[model samples]
Target: MLPGVVGTIQATEAVKLLLGIGEPLIGRLLTYDALGMRFREVRLRRDPKCPLCGTAPTITDLAVHRNGAGGACDVSPDGHPEGVAAAVAPKAGG
Candidate 1:
């Protein structure tokens, strides 16, 4: 799981660069106080070998499907649709 500090830093940097409304403070920590709560500091991480953000050049799309039973199905590599059974609740009498 990513630390909340990382998310906050990314969000703040994005807002500062894109909107140019707030001052960009990379080294110093920023705090948010709201609704009787307070938050402090932010952290950031980078994906070294991530295809989307790295030097590699390979990409794939994940297609998701839902059947009539309201269950999700994933398409296999061989182009076959893998069916997932829906969870059913047993009757009280049974």
Candidate 2:
């Protein structure tokens, strides 16, 4: 998702949630265009086959989401951090 478009919608919804003045975009997705001045809403639905949110979820531990390599980071094709295992040995108990 393009962060510029999505981030604006999320920021707007967060303010609405704080003020309680209008319905927040809870359980729904919104797309917007500033130049065209258009807004579109798509209702979100729970996925039965999603590993993180499925009915019989397989991913139970938050540790699974953590980097097994600790602080090491790998750059994704899109330039985001993905975990990479530590290669150089460390002195024990340092």
Candidate 3:
């Protein structure tokens, strides 16, 4: 039953995103417990004073937070194409 409900909600959100309609669960955390058969939603809100996406954001450059440790993507230890699939894709697209 829990899986059924979760799948239904996931499908519903997918359709909503495709059509750009309905209020999606963007600002809420939904949880379900199978044994209890309970569903709960916790409202989420952004901090107004935070630098990122705030009224007066100061952090404009994202390079400061970029993880340059892995400067370049390379093949996995095993040298398998499928294993390095993630390394092939860029972190962020253009």
Candidate 4:
């Protein structure tokens, strides 16, 4: 049931994007609470300090991925893209 609902939403969004009709959730996140039967929309903002889309992006090309896993541009040996910062949460009480 949850998969059906989520799939329908994804299909609808794809159709809207292909047809260029109606407002699509581009930078907004749609969260569904199945237990409470509620839906919430969260507007996302671009982080200026982000390495990918930041004002001064360090990674401007995909050349770093050339030496990825088996030279397949999948992922580096470090389990993250080269020249990009890996998202790591701070340890609790560290």
Which candidate tops TM-score? 4
Local error of candidate 4 at residue 91 (angstroms): 20
lDDT agreement with native, every candidate: 0.46, 0.58, 0.62, 0.66
Cα-based lDDT at residue 14, candidate 2? 88
Candidate 4 lDDT over residue span 4-92, tens digit each: 77789999999999999999998777866689999877666676655567787655777756766443334234533332223232233
Model 1 CA deviation exceeding 4 Å by range:
1-36, 60-94
Candidates in descending lDDT order: 4, 3, 2, 1
Alpha-carbon RMSD, each predicted model: 14.4, 13.2, 13.4, 9.0
| Pairs that clash in candidate 1 | 5-43
The Cα error of candidate 2 at residue 47, in Å, is 0.8
User: Which 10 successive residues of model 4 have the least lDDT summed?
Assistant: 85-94
Clashes of each: 1, 0, 0, 0
Score every model by TM-score: 0.28, 0.48, 0.47, 0.62
Please give, for residues 1-94, the per-residue lDDT of candidate 3 as tens digits. 6568778988999999899999998877576667887887766566454455667765566643565735433323353223223433323411
lDDT of 1 at 30: 51
Please report the TM-score between candidate 3 and the true structure.
0.47
Q: Candidate 1: how large is its RMSD?
A: 14.4
What local lDDT does model 4 show for residue 41?
72
| Better-scoring candidate (lDDT), 2 or 4 | 4
